[model samples]
Target: MKRILRLLYYMRRYWWQALASVFLMAAVGLLDAFRVLLVQPIFDHVLHPGSPSQIISLYKIPGTHYQFTLQQFVPHFIHNVWAVVAFTLVVSTLLKSVCDYAGTYLVNYAGFGMITDLRDDLYEAVLRRSLSFFQKHATGTLLSTLINDIERVQYAMSSVLSEFLQQFFTLIFTIGVVVHFGGKLSWALLIFVPVVIGSIRRIGRDVRQTTRRGQDRLAEIQNILHETITGNRIVKAFNMEFWELLRFRDAAKRLFKANLRSVRAQAISSPLMDSIGAIAIALLLLVGRGQIQRGAMTEGAFFGFIVALFKLYDPVRRFATFYNNFQQALGASSTIFTFMDDQDDLVEKHRAFTLKGFQKSIRIEDVGFAYRDDEGEKNVLHNINLEIRCGEVVALVGPSGAGKSTLVNLIPRFFDVTSGRILIDGHDLRDVSTRSLRDQIGKVTQETILFNDTVRNNIAYGQPDVPIQRVQDAARAALAHDFIMRLPEGYDTLIGEKGFRLSGGERQRLAIARALVKDAPILILDEATSALDTESESLVQAALSNLMAGRTVVVIAHRLSTVRRATRIAVMEQGHITAIGSHEELMQQSPIYQKLYQLQFMDVQELPEPVMMGKSGL
Candidate 1:
């Protein structure tokens, strides 16, 4: 009920249009009932062929005050009756047509406005939700809510609101006219109504349930599409395209079945309602004939009663259809409301810390993290501690599953530590504004996530409004300028999907240029050259060395040569930072680091020792 009330409340902003539309519809109903009144006179004068004197009892000339009965004034009698009948029919027809146009225009205006607002509101709600909301919900499920569900709700708005208002008013007005024409016969309608009402409601309930299932199936369809697009390479490599195609087909078939059920429910309401109405009309006719024979009602009155009763049945049939449409909108409303009310994963602190500058060091004090999967088993990172001095290059290296990536991930507060704290300079990471904290660091990952934008835009991505010359200089620093200029459109050339058109080294170089353009005081390189061939790795490494100049750099190292160049190396194992020292020092002290060196560098030129980067005289 609250959901329905909220929907009505929002729709109330367009109430002037809705009210005007309804009033016009009511006028049309009244006019329709008025036409029933004309039937009595039509029967008495024209159908019955009443005496001329009786048909035209009162006649006054336009320019003279002479009046006479139709027995003496037959010409005036015929003219007046024909004129009045034609004029009344024309006026009633015109009023009905005008009323329909007004109602249609106003109702449609409000319906369109309501749906447009809802679409915009839902989109805004999606953007405002935190990362955790995204993690918990599939991207495809959200797409379902945005597209399929929103469209369903909008489709319902037209029939549900307009038909409800118009049909309900028509029903009430038709009832009043039927009672005015013959009261006792009107009461006989009550018997047949309950059965039809109950049956239609049963159908509506089924439709509501099936509509929800249909939306869920649509979500599954969206999920399959999103996954297929994102993991196309994986699908190709594994040769599972056929399996994915079958899965999508199954999801679509389920949706088709669900929608078919909803359609059946919606389709039955009108016919069933109309059949019940027809039975009620038949009952009225049976009782009404006796009243006419006893002279309790005129022939015209009986005819009028049946006419209004049949006309009244249309609105009742329409009301049942409106209920079915309302159910569809109700199903979608739940998803929209859920999106609007979601709790954000990251929130601005009550008293957000003021981030001034990097001073002493970034201290990780006994930081531990665990990412729990669906079954509640956690992948843990345990008791990791490090202090990174400003303007020093620190590298992290160990065997697979060492949690090195996770440790660096915490420093940027991408994921909060499960235990202990990460402090920037001296302020706790949680206390600072996320935007402010992130602004102080630049990250270049192994997967260079370049947008399908031009070279200039990609380089200036961090600072969108940065000058082109500054962007050029950054690209030059990253050694990406030469290749970018060679493209047909030069800096304006579009990078294909995920920088597909560019080489692996070229994409990494572009990413470095983007980071360099930002000129952040701290930089993070997450195995940026790990997947590259030696020539490309050399290029990326050279670019990396230039990038680390005068900045605090954190490297997640896969190569022994890269680890050797770091000022300090941290060895992590089983979620803990087991060792940290210079390459020579770690080789002497850390078995994990020593083993990593032997295994990784054995195929290439061996490294003598780990280097330790320190501040001047620090």
Candidate 2:
């Protein structure tokens, strides 16, 4: 009920439409009741006017508490009895049709409008969540909630609102007619009301529980589909197609079983209610027959009462079905609300200042970090300090899991340090807005991330409206202009997913071109040339050199040859910087550095002169 109320709150903006729908639906109900009431007059007057007294009595409104005849209300000009009945029936039917159509339209308009707002807000909320939030939740589960779960809520809103409102009013009006005509017979039927209510409540509870489990199983199927499709390449490479198929089959089977349970629960409501209604109707018939024969009730009135009683039960049955559907919708809404209510722990402070630009250096003081998992918090980095000066190329070299990439990640505040603070130009990084802080830093990782877009768009990704001439200049600087021009469509060619159409070197060059376009003061290159072939590596290395010129650069490289030209080098081991000095100084003084240099540069004659003889390469 709370979830339903929350959904209605979204409809506040469309209150006028909702009110119009309700008004029209109420009119529809009133017309339905009037049509049933016409049964008495049709039998008493038109079909068999057994006596003059019967004719006079037929003129009376059948179901009204007061015995006011239609003759009293009709104008004298409208005199023919058959013409009056014909005209009234035809007009009532036509008016009911119009009101039903208009009512349905208005309700659907408001319901769909509410769904549109919900989907948009859900998307925005997901986008605003912190990176860690995405890490914690599965993409497939989130996708299911955003699309499938919300779709269920949409179905409930449209079907439930229209049917519930219309049927509720119809039930009320018909019950009034039945009570007025049948009196004692209607009161006898009330004895079974509590029984019907109890049955509906129990069935609805079972349906809600089953539906929730069904939805969860459906989400698992969706997750499996998402994983298999996205990881198709990995599956093919490892020849695990049959294994993936088996996994999908398992998920589908589970979902089928879950849905079957919900289906059984939903199917039980109709027949169960019908049987209960049958017993009540049989009792009503048995009692009403005696009243009709004993002169307590007229034959026409007894027949009309039966019609009204049946009409009343129709809405009751529909409401029972609606209750089950509402429970299903509530189950879906709970998952969606859970996601919406989650707060990002790393939200920026309201008044944080924007960092304008980089000036002197980036100082990492006493920084420690840990990643939280199911087991416990595992510390990755201990107290570490390093200073990177402007216009200097400093390379970070270490073995795998040596915290080289983690240290560079800290500069951009991707994950805040668990302990100490980092400062940029004497200002604490925490005091600055993330956007402003990241605006001055450019990164090019080994994996070359590119969107499935045109070559021109990919190059000018960050600054989408950048001039063509500027984009061409950046491409030329990164040595990507020639290959781009040689392509069939030149700059406008659509790159396939992740720029898969391009070679490793071409893709890396485009990444460099994107960084060049950003033209930030600080740059971080994480193994940028590590994955390319010899010729590709040379082209990519040259592009990297052009991108690094006069910028405050942090390079994390496993290839010692690549970092040989750095103004200084920091050697990290475990979670600490073991040494920081010129490449030669570290080679002579630090055994770790010497071991790495000797392993990679074993042939001294092939070593770059600057590294062998301690000369400045930059």
Candidate 3:
């Protein structure tokens, strides 16, 4: 019930449409009941053509001598029984059909509208989540919740919701008819109502539980499929085609079993309700016959009562099916709500001001950071302190797992420090709006993330309307223009996913071009040239020199030539900055730096002299 109420909250914006649909469906239900009442007039007056025309009593007020006549409903001109019956049937049927059509359309409009907004908000919510959220949740599981779960909810809101409303209203009016004619005998049929409802509720509960399991199993299949597709190169290299297929098959089988469980639960409810309905009908027949024999009920009235009772069961049976479907939708909604309900932990401070520009120096005051995993929090950086002023080229050089990348990431506010604070131009990063803070920063990483887009579009990525001249200039600065012009479409060439169509060095050059176009005040180069060949690394370094000119640069360098160009080199050991000085100063002052330089030359005595030249010795 709580889940259902939460689902209805999404419909608040479209309540007018929902309300109008309800009124129309109510009219449809009333007309349906009126059709059953018309049966008696047809048998008692219209079918007996020689009988005199008289007013027909539509309903008798239960406790008084008052009754409602057909004359009160139809025009005065329709006095004859045949005309009245024909008019009522034709007009009522037409009205019922019209109401059903309009009601269905309106309800669907509201349902679809609500779901569309819901899907948009869900997508926005997922996008707004912090980087840590993505780490905790699998890509495939999030995709399933975004798409498949929402689809199930949409089906329930549109088709199932419309049908349920119609059935509910019809059941109400049909019961009214049954009570008017069946009178005391109606209680026998009504007695089974509790049993049918109980059966539906029990079956629906089982269906919901099984459906949730099925959704989880489906997410597993999606995860396996996503992994296989994204990591196809790894799978192929390891000759794991057969292994992957087996894994997929196992997940598929689990999903199949879950679906079968839900199907079995839903399928049994229909027959159970049918049996209960049959028992009620049998009892009604016996009692109804006695009433007719004693002249307490007319033959036409008894037949109409039985017809109305059958009609009542129609909605009741559909109610069971609808309930099961709604429960299935509820199961899916539970997963969606879990994602939507999560508060974004990385929310900006209220009234946070934007960083207008970068000036002075960035101060990392006794910063500490920890990454949380299943084993709890593990410290990544400890008591780290550094300062980089404008136009200063500071490089962080350390062995692997020394927190170089983690520390660099904190500059852009990707993750907040566990203790202390980072100040940009005397303004705390936390007090500044993240968007504006990041906008002033540019980054180039070793991975070189490029989209499946034209060279020009990729270069001018975020600013789609950037002038072509700026794109060409940035490409030239990054030394990517010559290679880009060689492509079949030049700047218009469609680079395949992650720029697969390009060589590793060419892709890296393009990433540099993108950063050059960004032209932010602060630059972070994270192993920017680590993966390139010597020739490519030289060209990228030349490009990095242009990108680094006059900008406050923080680079995580692996190459000796790059480290030598820095204003100061910070040597990290474990999670602490053990030394900060020029290369000569570090060699004289720090043992770790001395040993690291010695190790690089240790194996280089036998190699060709050219290999040792411009090498990253530490």
Candidate 4:
């Protein structure tokens, strides 16, 4: 019930439309009751051709306690019975049709409006979540929540609101008319009321539970589809198409069974309600005949009473169905609300200082870090200390899992250090706003992250309105201008997904151009050239050199030749900095550095001579 109320809270913005719809639906119910009452006059007066007293009695105001007749309200000269009945039926039917159309339109207007507002707000909340949140949740499951779950909720809200209003008013009006005519005979309906209510409650509970499980199964199917389609290349390379198909089939089968269970539960309510209603009708008829024969009821009134009683059950049955649908919507709402209420792990401080630009140097002091895992916290880096002055290129080199990438990631505060602090210029990274801190840094990774956009837009991604001439100049410096001009539409051509239309070297060059256009004071290149072929590597390496001209650069590379030109080399091993010096200095003084260098170059082939020798006599 709380979740349902929360869903209704979204309707506050559209209250006027809801109110109008309710009033119109109430009018519709009054018209329906009048239609049933007309049957009494048609049977007793128009069809029977009764005497004047009998006809006048049938025209009495429709209530047990009220005795005034329509003849008292109209002149006898204009009160021809056939003309009055014909005119009343035609006008009432026409008015009811208009009210029905207007009422349905208003309700749907409010429903669709609420859905639009909810979807926009939910999407904005998703965007505000941290990187770690996305790491934990699957893309397909989130998509299912945003698209599928919200769609289900929309159907439920619209259907339930429309039917609930119409049926509630109809039930009230019909019950009033039944009691006015049938009196004691109407009490027979009380027996079936509890039965209907109890059955609806039980069926609704089962449907809600089964529907939640079905939605979960549907999410799993979406996850599989997302994975297989996005990673189709890998699937084909490994020849696992048949395997993926079988997995999809299994997930789909589970979803089918779950939906069947939910459907079976939801479908049971109508027939059960109808059967119970039939029994109540039988009891009413048996008692109604006795009242008619005893002259306690008019034959016209008795037949009208039967019609109103049966019509009352229509709304009752609809209410039961509405309950079933409302339960399904509640299941979907639970998933959506849970995600919206989740707190982000990375929260910025209030009124945090903003960094304008880089100054002297960056200092890493007594840093330690760990990544959370299923077993427990696993340490990734410990007791790391380093100082990088402005305009110096410091190359971080080591074996896999040596924490080179993790150490550099600390500067950007991607994940905060578990122990010590890092300072840029003089301000602690944590003390400054993340947007301001990141604005001063640019990064290019081995896997180039390019959007499916034109060359002009991709190069000027961060600053979309950057001048065309500046974009071209940045591309020229990155050596991408030449190939870009050879394309069909030059800079206006659309690059396919992730720039797959371009070759490896072209894609890396475009990534470099993007960073060059941003022109931040600090840069980090993580294995940027390692994936390309020989020729592509030379082109990309030259572009990297130009990009690193005067920035404080942190280059993490496994290739020995790539880092040879750095101002200094820092050798890391097992989460600690083992040595830091010039490449030649480290080669002679540090055995760990020497072992790595020898393994890569194999006896210093195509390299400079040794500048010094250590006690180890390398």
Candidate 5:
């Protein structure tokens, strides 16, 4: 019931349209019942030509002595009984048809408008979630919720809800007719209604459960499809085509079984409701026949009553289908609401300050972190402390899984530290607004990320209004200007997905240009040139030199030679920073740093002295 109310709340913005549709539906229902009322007049007056123009009581106003007649409905000019009946029939039918059309369109307009707002809010909520939320939820599962689940809801809102309202109003008017004619007999005949309603409700519950299960299986199928399509290169290189096909087939079969169960649940309701309706009609016929023979009821009145009963039952049957569809929508809404209700823990404080510039050191004070804060999860970084001064390049050297990347990730508050805090320019990072903190930091990773956009757009991504000349200057600094000009469209060339149109070195250079364009006070490079060939690495390394110039840089690298000339090198192992010093200072004081250098540079030529950097440093 709460979920139902929530759905109605979404429709509140379109209340005027929905209310108009309801009024139209009510008029259609009354006109339909009025058409049934005409049956009595035709039999009593029109069919019997000698019969007098008697007043036919169509309806009695509730709690009043007043009653409506066919005479009141027909035009004053129409004196003949047959003509009056014919005129009323044509007009009532036409009016009912008009109201039905207008009601359907208006209801659908309200429904579509509500869904547009709902989908937009859901999308914005998903984007606002922290990185951990995305890491926990699969991309395909989120897509299924955003697309397939919402589609089911859309159908229910636009189609099922409109039908339900129309039929509901029709049922009310038809019931009034049945009560007026059948009198006390109507109560006895409708005893079977509760049984039919109970059966429908039970079937609807089963359908909802099975529909949820089917949606889950569908999500699994989507997940496999996304993974196989996006990672096609890896799958082909591994020669696992058959394996992927089998995996997809398994998920498809599971979904098929789930859908079958939902079908079974929905199928049971129709026949059960129909059988009960048939029994009630049979009883009404048996009783109605006696009422007519005893002269207690007129033949025409009994016939009109039978017609009204049929109309009532028609809407009842439609209600069963509507309830089933409503259940399916509710199942989908349950998942959507779960995500919408989730609040990200990384929310900024109400009075959080916006950081404008980096004026002092970034102090990491005994920081400890774990990806998951729940018990039984191991810490990725432990008791880690470091200080990086302005305009200094501090390189973090460690083996794989030594928390090098994780520690740098903390500086940007991608995930908050499990314990302790990081301060930038003497203020806690947590006290700063996330957008402002990220705005002042630039990052370039080993795997370049470039969208399927023009090279110019890619370079000036964040600053969309940046002048073309500034973009060219940044590109030149990153060693990317020469190649960009050689393309068919120069800077306007459309780089395909992930910049696949460019070479590894060219892509890396473009990423550096993006960072150069940002010109952030702080820079983070994680294995920036490690993936490239030697020649490519040299070019990227030179570009990196330009990017790191006069910035507070924190670099993560496995190759020891790259950082031998850094302002300071921090050696990390097993989540702990074991040493922090210059190359010569670390060689004498730290054995871990000494052994790492000896093991990595044993087969390569080592620089004899610390190389001095001019304006730019590598």
Candidate 6:
């Protein structure tokens, strides 16, 4: 409830629209009630002037001498009555058209405006969430919230305004008509109201529960759909099309069953209420007949009583329908509110600490961390101590699972370290605003995730407002400028999704170009050139050398050549640095480094001994 209230708070500025909708709905409902009340005037003033046979013609058809019957009376009459009926019909038709148009305009117009804003706000919330937040909720589930959940609440909003306002007004207006017709008979319904309302409340509760289950099922379907689309390659590679289809079918079936149950209950409610209302109508008719027999009220009065009875129940039926909608609305709104109610993962300090310029260095003192899982056990990176001074270049090298990426990730506080403090230029990284801290570093990783945008857009992404000449220079250093110029659209050529259209080398170079453009002081290169072929690697290596000339660079290298260029190589094993020295020093002192060097070093220039007289070194 609080969640929805906050959503409503955003809509406060649109109150004029909501106010107008309510006004239109109330006006329309009362006008409908007035139309129903017109029956009394027709019965008394037009139809029952005297005996039925005493009715006279109001117009003349000279050619055929045709006469309109009672069914087509008033406007069709062959007398003065024709003129009055025609005028009355024209006026009533106009009011009905105007009221219907205004009601439609206000209700739908406002519902769309409110929910569209709601979707944007919901998306904004998602974007503001941390990367870990995305890991916890799949694209499908989040997408379901954006689409299905919001749509469900939209109907709830429309129903709330339309049904609640219209029915309440109609009920009041009908009560007046009923009491005017016959207060005693209308009072009889007072006793019956409690039973009907009690039954409605019971049914409404079940409808809400079922509606919630239906939405949950929809989320599953959404999640499965997202998985299949994104993992379509894997599905095809594994020949699991049938399995994927089955998974989606299962999710769809669950949603179908849930919706069928909910809608069945909702469908039965109205007809059941209508049947009961018919019995009540029959009771009113009988009571009215008795009054007519006793000469207490005339036949016209009895007729009017029944007419008023129908009018009262019309609003009652609508109110019951509104209750059904309210139940489903509550079910949908609960999820939306829950999403809106979440506290942001990163809590910002009330006052941000501002730093003037970079001076000293980055320090990781006795730093340790673990990937915290749901089960509360921390995986270990212990007794870690490392430092990177200004203008220094260090390389981190180890086997596959050595936590090279994770260690660097902590520098930017992408994930806060589990049990250590990282200081940047003498200030704790946490104390510095994440934005300000990140602004001081640049990164280029192996898997270059590029958007489907122009080459200019991708290169200048890190610094969008950078001048064109600077962007061009960075591209030239990346060796991407010549190729980009050769493309059909030059720098404006659109890269396909994830840069799929570009060769592996081209994509890697683009990423380097982006990093170079930012020109941040502290740079982390995570196997940045791993995917490039020998030719591309050679070209990128030159570009990278230029890019790393003066920056405080930390390179996480797997290949031997990349590491040899680092000023200092930190040999990491099991998440801790085992040896820290230049390539020559490490090759002499580090045993692990010697083992790796021996394993890859060129064997004897020409077979050390004479190969068994023949076969040589075949």
- True-structure RMSD, every candidate: 7.8, 5.9, 4.1, 5.6, 5.8, 8.0
Worst 10 residues of 6 by lDDT: 51-60
Q: For model 3, where is the 10-residue window of minimal lDDT?
A: 600-609
In model 2, the runs with Cα more than 4 Å from the true position are: 49-78, 528-530, 597-618
The sequence of per-residue lDDT tens digits that candidate 4 reaches over residues 59-116 is 3454566675544434456578767777767777898889888888888889888888
* Per-model TM-score versus the true fold: 0.84, 0.89, 0.92, 0.89, 0.92, 0.85
lDDT of 6 by residue, 1-618 (tens): 565476567567678877786777677666666555556546654675554443333223557878543334344444544345445556666775686677766766677778888878788888777666676777877887888888877886764655577677777876776776675767888877986898789888888899889888988998898788877889999999999999888888899999999998788788878987898998888888888788886666667678778877877776667877777777877877666666755665767676565667999988887764578756556767888998888888776677777788888777767777889989987788878888888898867889999999999995678888998999998888988888889888998888888888888889989998988888888875345667987887887887888899888876667778788888777888788898899888999777656553324343245546556745
lDDT of 6: 0.76
How accurate locally is residue 8 in candidate 5, as Cα lDDT from 0 to 100?
A: 87
Off by over 4 Å in 4: 51-78, 598-618
Model 1 segments more than 4 A misplaced: 12-82, 88-99, 354-357, 377-379, 462-464, 533-535, 601-618
Model 2 / residue 499 / CA error / Å: 2.5
Query: Which pairs clash in the backbone of model 5?
Result: none
User: Which digits, one per residue and each the tens of the lDDT, describe model 2 over residues 245-293?
Assistant: 9988998899899999999998989998899888889988988899988
Write down the TM-score for model 4: 0.89
Q: Candidate 3 at residue 535, lDDT?
A: 92
Pairs in steric clash, model 3: 560-616
User: In angstroms, how far off is 84's CA in candidate 1?
Assistant: 4.0
Task: Look at candidate 2 and tell me the lDDT of residue 339.
Answer: 85
Top-scoring candidate (lDDT): 3
Q: Which stretches of candidate 5 lie over 4 Å from their true place?
A: 61-66, 373-375, 558-561, 598-618
Each prediction's whole-model lDDT (CA): 0.81, 0.85, 0.89, 0.85, 0.88, 0.76
lDDT of 5 at 479: 92
* Model 4 backbone overlap count: 0
Clashing pairs in 4: none
* lDDT-better candidate, 2 vs 6: 2
